[model samples]
Target chain A: MTQPTLGVWDVAAVSALLLINGALSVWLSLGIARQLLVAALRMVAQLAAVGALLTVLFGAASPIWTLAMASAMVLFAGYEVTARQTRRLAGGWGPGLGTATMALAAATVTLVALVGPLRPDPWHEARVAIPLFGMILGNAMTGVGLGLDTLTTAVVRDRAALDARIALGAPRFEALRPVIREAMRRGLIPVINAMAACGVVFLPGMMTGQILAGAPPGDAVLYQVLIMILIAGATGLGLLGAIVGGAWRLTDHRHRLRLDRLAPARPAS
Target chain B: MTNAEILTLRGLTSTALKDCNLTVAPGEIVVVQGPSGSGKSLLLRAIADLDPHQGAAWLGPLDRARMSGPAWRRMVRYVAAEPAWWADRVGDHMRHPKRAAELAVSLGLAADCLDWPVTRLSTGEKQRLGLARALEDHPPVLLLDEPTAALDDAATRAVEALLKRRRDDGVAMVLVTHSDAQAARLANRRLMIRDGCLRDAVS
Candidate 1:
């Protein structure tokens, strides 16, 4: 039950649907016509680039190439994490630590899934490894970034409260216990929400893509469930790493809240 | 204890305070008067090891650098002007509710105010509770920054009495205040800070 392939005219015909949307935007004075066109163009270009790369990758199916692509994906995701942070650690620590933790989490979970359950041919096949690694890295990066950003912001905003606790004889960890918990929760919320809303509220992208590619509905559901669980696990690990590492880097042995280590918050765009 | 330890700040400099040298004797009160932004608060923060500064500070023979920041802070507690409360219930912060009760009674807080939510506390209440919370740690040296600034005359007198009692109990105190009358009433020696330098105020 394979899906039919789209020819060039079919793509042009499908793209015409976007014209209707653009026309409606123009008619409504939404001022989003340019944005819609630009976004559509970007999507087409990005997908084409990705399609070309994937075709080469699938043909090669070499472990080294798969690992290299995975590494590149993790690196890009890590950069996105650091760039998204409102209040970040100064210097290389923010991005360096973030990337390190996200990679650790994504790699660990992906390996477990590959070896344990979804053992594809050659185990590290590009088709299985790249997409799995991509999903884990992308999700874990967001989680860790949220954790670090929230922790820093909370520390800065509640510094007086933290100092008061320290003054009252709280140890460093004890003083920061609440902030750390809040940060971890913030990091986990996205994954949790996705899990909660899966199947009932929305069909996840991976499941839809799998079904569109003519995979069995039951198989797609099973894979989606496994991926969601793996994402949650990766997110948890990455977030914990970021918060603990961030907390350690932000303070010294003397238990002083060395907020000086944090780069100043950037103004909202 | 140990001949009433002395707190000495020698050539301490921060962005706010210049090479300031001063000594505070245990059981003695040194009132610091200064214009706003004159670094009175910064002086206390530096001595408490809360901020980076040049030079040295010592409690008797123990150098500030020799001990951890927490250790130094535990010995020399700084009560900021606007204290912070993180806990929902006021009693959650009190290590010694019995002592707090006694202090609260003296400070005019209701008997059960400890059980009240911190969000319900007024600024004056928070200020008084901040003092009580600091005292719970029983720091040997006290760096008070305008502790009574938010209080009324009667409340101010009550705080003065409480602080004077602590002074008599052999606690070294550096009182940062703007009130000349408070200096006259409580200080054995009064110092004025202007342009980050400390000078002895004429009695």
Candidate 2:
């Protein structure tokens, strides 16, 4: 069944339904009316902008443009990941490592999807490639960021134990075994939880979008599952790669943990 | 193994020590006495290669330059005042569980206590167990920083006796302590750190 399209007046009439919540918030003294309105406005603006850009790109369907857009998105994602870290590598190493890892993970997974499963008529179809690239890179970025943050914080907080392990004849990997394990576990948790909740608790965003755009529920569900699997794989690999790279930068050839390589974290409020 | 090797540090400089030169032969115990925050612990850490420093340290003919950090640490063990144990089970940290059990028994810990979680251990118990863990490696030289500070008289005596046994077995030791009696009892040579300079303690 084809879903009915919402024109300008239809969208406006439905958007006005938010006024009911705004009135309720005012009556309850919630003070969230302004925030609610501002958030809705920002969401509209961002989505509209992305929609326009996607429209143009999909029409052009140029592989070069698609690649360039994917690169830009991955670069931004990398920057966001590094920026979110509480304790990151000093100088350019943290961002550089994050960008490289994210790019590698996202590109690898997107290519596999494009060539292996999706197998679109034209290999670099903008609609298929861009969204897949964005989803993979976006999830991988968060995973890498979480892993780096957790490992760095663990290093600083459990420094005494780490040194003690080293002093007790443990090699570098052995000394960091616990922290590394915890970091990777924390990194992979988001994707794992999303996978668990996808169909049972709530329909995932990708599946909902596809169903809303007139795809069959079964097809959307299958695609969503496949995408989640790819996300989990990419995120896990990205986290492991980024953490190992960051860890290497934090130590020397002699297996000494060099705190100097880390930017000092600000004290929590 | 080799008879009575020496731990020699020459021109060693760290946040705690400056151009420090010292040597302790196997079977010798050098007690370092100093005021609080006098870098006594840092000196021990420097010798253990846990901290960055200038100058060279040698375990007999083995130079610090020639050995990996872990290898150097294994030969020269540093037991901090507050020991850090990463494992939940005490036995997990011991390289030699049987030797650890023997040391634990001598240090007034039950042999089965190794299987106990670290959270179940008291401060004194943990400290004593930490000593056992370090000694399990059978380091040639031991750097001790107030190792018995948290113990009572009986516990302190138990630790002191175990250390004395290690000394008799030709394990060179640098012991940093504030206890004058401990210094008096254990020192083959007593040195005091004042303003970062090592000098002979006043008799």
Candidate 3:
């Protein structure tokens, strides 16, 4: 009982639903009709492009190609992390730190999962490795971005408090512990919520997709659990790396609160 | 390098402030008077090792270069004009609540003020508490930036009196202020800073 494959008209049927949204927007003078149209178009185009690329990647099934795809994803994720920040570190550290930490966390977790549990016939098999890497990278990216954003924003807002603590003889790490704890909590909250709400509040996207693809429910559940556990590990490690790196970048060996190292915040859009 | 000089700065230079050299003997208050944005705060921040600056500062015989920033700051504390409170209650911000409470009482703060939420503190009250917070550990050297800028006359007198008491206890201080009367009353030696330059004021 395999799920019917989606065709162009089947996709168009779904796409047509947007016309109703567009019509309502026009009727209400919401001014978002064009935006909605453009967003829908972009989503369709982007997803199609990714689907095509993944097909080609799977056919090739080469380790180098798989690595290249994963690296590209990691790079884009790093850029997204930086773009999400309101007040980023000065001197290109925003992206540099994010990319480095995300790559490290995602790559480490993905490699461990592949080698340890999944154990694909070829451990670096593109079909298995690329998707797994993408899922972990996506979740880890969000965590790292949130952690970095929280840390930088809090540090800027609480500069005086940090300075006072440092002046009061607190070490840099000791002074930043509270802020870092907040960052870690914020970074992990989404994943934690997903874990709590999985299967009950709503089936997670991966499990839903697997079920639709006709995988056995028990197998899908086990796989989803494994992926989620791996994601949590990756997110935790990535957030910790990004936050600690941010804290280190914000201060110096002399323990001065280097608020100057942070660029002046851009006005909220 | 005088043994009597508890706090000594030799050629301290920051981005805004240049080539500042001064010394404060134990039990002395060196009042720095300058117009706003004269880099007075920069000078104190540099001495506290809170900002990057070129110079050597010594706490008595100990060169600041040898000690970590926190270690140096422990002995030579910098109290900002508007000190920051990180916690909800004033007591949470103080390392030694009992000592801070004792100091707060002397500074005209209510005995129970430490238990009050930080939001309830007026500007003058925060200033006094900032002083009390800094004094809790009995740092040998204090770099005070406009410590009484927010106080009323009576409150100002109380803070000044407390500062004088700290000085009498051999706590050397470099105090930044705009008040000449306060300077005259408190400073054993007065200096003036203008456009990031420091020199002896012609009294």
**lDDT by candidate, in order shown:** 0.88, 0.87, 0.90
For model 2, residues A242-265, the per-residue Cα lDDT tens digits are: 878876776666666777789878
What digit string (tens of lDDT, one per residue) describes model 1 on residues A1-269?
A: 55977687889888888899999999999989999999999998988997899899999988888888888887788789888888889999978989999899899999999999999878988888888988888889878988888899999999999877776556688889999999999999999999999999999999999888889999999999999999999999988988999988877776767899998899632
Task: Please give the C-alpha DockQ score of model 2.
Answer: 0.68
TM-score of each: 0.92, 0.92, 0.97
- Report the lDDT tens digits of candidate 1 across residue range B30-118: 99998998889988887777766788989999988888777778788888989998889999888899888778878888989899999
Tens-digit lDDT track of model 3 for B1-203: 11234788999888788799998889999999898999999998999999888999887789999999999998888999999988999999988999999999998889999999999999999999999999898998889999999999999999999888888888899999988989989999999999889999998
Using lDDT as the yardstick, the better of models 1 and 3 is 3
lDDT of 3 by residue, A1-269 (tens): 65868778887888778999999999999999999999998998989999999999999988999989998998889889888988899887968998898889999999999999999979998889988999999999989888888999999888888888998889999998889998999999999998999999999899989888889899999999999999999999989999999999899999988888998798533
Residue B55 displacement in candidate 2 (angstroms): 2.5
Better of 2 and 3 by lDDT: 3
Which is the leading candidate under lDDT?
A: 3
**DockQ preference between candidates 2 and 3, better one:** 3
Off by over 4 Å in 1: A1-24, B1-4
Query: Candidate 2 at residue A233, lDDT?
Result: 85
Over the full model, what C-alpha lDDT does candidate 3 score relative to the true structure?
A: 0.90
Let me know the TM-score candidate 3 reaches against the reference structure: 0.97
In order of lDDT, best first, we have 3, 1, 2
Question: By DockQ, highest first, what's the ranking?
Answer: 3, 2, 1
